[model samples]
Target: MIQRFKASLAITLAIILSFTAVFAGPKDTYASTVAVEAKSAILVDAETGKVLFEKEADLTLPPASMTKMMTEYLVLEAIDEGKISWDTTTQISQYAFDISANPEYSGVGLKLNKDYTVRELYEAMAVNSDNATTIALAELLAGTEGEFVKMMNEKAKEMGLPDYEFVNSSGLNNSHLDGNHPEGTEPDATNLLSARSAALLAYHLINDYPESLEFSGQTTAEIDGQKVTNWNWMIPNMPGSLSQFGYEGVDGLKTGYTDLAGNCFTGTAERSGQRFIAVVMKADSRPSRFRQTAKLFDYGFQQFQRKELFEEGYQIDGESELPVTKGKEDVVELETNDSLSTLVKKGDEENYTIKYNISKDKLDANGKLVAPVEKGQKVGTAELVYSGEDQYDNILSKKTNTVDLVTTSSVEKANWFMLMIGGIGEFFSDIFSGAVDMVKSWF
Candidate 1:
């Protein structure tokens, strides 16, 4: 009997192992198949700004040249604000010349005595990944790289990237040098960023400088009659470089590397209809950075889809007609202030539905409003229902998108008061008519 009990236990163990194997297969596949070795990595949807995948994404590390993304962000902001124009010319300052001449730094090899337009510098900085051009642009914008670094840090904080810290606009080491002096002492400048922060910076640039892609997305350039090609390998090799990933809907961002950072990349890709940002830091090597990013893009485009929740000016629902007080029109229409859209799983389109509810007590006896309804007013709430099993059904079901119901302009408070007075007048008129008819019948 003891031997039989042992055999039964063995069979039960085998069954449990089989079940675990079935469930663990997909998890193991993801772990084993991803070859890139990075301390941190993240893939996010550009449209919805949703994180699709993450691995130690928040751990801060040396960002190398990826710090240039913030530099680029400020440059574009300047352009947008008209502080600088594309044709604006910037001279090569002594500092800019020094960075370019320094063999230890990445530079565009700009002639010390020459001047380049803001457009040229932007292209070189973005496309060739020129550290020197980036520094020069910063100095030109803020008068000094130190001040610019301060601006960069401030911008990071404003954007809520708390883990990011900028010591130099060029992202060079500075600790080896005297704290007050940036010159000499190997400049010891290093840029700091995390996978999550890098992605966020890219997101902000793409959002703020939609025009940045016109430069970063270029695979090649001819500045000052010399040809330069973009260092972002994925732009050339990706299947839809210009047609699909071009920064028009996309924007020019930056990539980074160091022996310690190990080939980091923060990239943005946008088709007019869709946009996505992918960040991989400390990737095992140059090739792996692109590979990991491609994986991110594939997962983003394949697994998720965007659904329109509601369109602006869309009529949500109408119960009984709302009363209008004292206006040319006696009713108001409710609508959403803005169109609503959400990223959903690819196959879940038909399963989603929207339900709207409005407060009935807010209306007058005539079914009109009491004259306080505004256009795109939040008069109703909408719930999105899905049919299939939900991974986050309980959490998601509790949240609903609100729809705006617009009120007619004629439905004003004054008009409503006048309407009430008119109603009273009509009531008195009916009473007087009945009394006169009674008196005539008696005669």
Candidate 2:
């Protein structure tokens, strides 16, 4: 009877453990990873720069034609800085002309010694992934493709890309440059960027020059009477093969391919007022990149949402007011200056706390705000501190999970008589406290 009783207890414990594992929720299956078919991949919220998912995101690999993203950024910057305009024209060099004339490379035919406007070349490079046109724009802006490569590296550093190397304006292997690779780069060198770096670059591009999408989103465009088609088949409403892989809200990004890089795509999509950027590098096939991107979008859209964790003017517990210095009021009511919203896993909204980050510049030596404070004046920021097991940093160099902290009402400086009275009270209070300490010591 004793042996039978012990066996029964063991069976009961095993059954309970099995049930617990079965009902732990679907999130348990993918809390730390998602199914992505690629060498390196990442998904990020466009507005917040918060990473939603990543897999081998820091592994450096060839970027292929995606290198033109930097070239495109530089051209747009030049145009915005008043150094060039869409109408500005430059004749192609021998190198550009030769590359354009080659059937092996992607290009629209360029006539030697003929002028091409910035608009024409930009459209060709953006929509068609034209290698020669990319070089032409680089030369036009930097006087040489080699110098433009320098600018690309500098800008990448400024943007805080975690890992990247830009050897040429176009992403072609140096051997493909027909023995005319950029002046400073080696013949074997090629452009390289990690999945995280590519996503970050795309984030900056989409946010900085949204106008570029006007071309990248195009299914097809005519340049000098030659038809050019966008290689990205994910664009909705695309012609012919669009029905096979068209994804809604996908528009305006870049694609890359080479023997070494395999297939890569930096894709962005929006739905129900939310936008996400996804990058897939070294995918096995041309279609695999788009399919992998679709999986990332499905995970993001189905499992997460932009939740308003804190409403506007919501006051934090124990931090509802701030001490005032030399003001009519001893304390000033405080609240969030604006709503704090961010992308979070659905149903996990209660797992965050507010961390007050009061700015020193707004305070006096006494760790209190000075008098004459205006209503709604920003004092510092309130950061949202997550208390969950799954936490990911934003792709940006700075954190985005914070909102401004502001004063609820204005406070005026106290009158001279009131100041004098307070000073007298504090001086006496200090003396009394010291006397009490002295008495205790003597005892």
Report the number of the highest-lDDT candidate. Answer: 2
Write one digit per residue (lDDT tens) for candidate 2, span 248-347.
9888699999897889999999898899999999899989999999999998999899888888898977777889988999899888988888888977
> TM-scores for all candidates?
0.68, 0.90
lDDT of 1 by residue, 1-443 (tens): 01223323433644565466556533234444344366567777764466666655655677888888888889989988999998998788776776776656666678877778888888888887777788789888998777787788889888877466677775655652235323221255455676777887877777777777777777777666778767676674433443343223334457777665678888777664777788888788777777777777776677777778566655545542355665555676555456667777667777766555666666566545665556545555554555644332111113444554444343445655676888899999999999999999999
In order of listing, the candidates' clash counts read: 23, 0
Angstrom error of the Cα, residue 158, model 1: value is 2.3
Q: After superposing candidate 1 on the true structure, give the runs of residues whose Cα lies further than 4 Å from its correct spot.
A: 1-37, 175-189, 223-225, 237-252, 309-339, 349-377, 380-443
* Candidate 2: worst-modelled 10 consecutive residues by lDDT: 1-10
* lDDT score at residue 190, model 1, on the 0-100 scale: 52
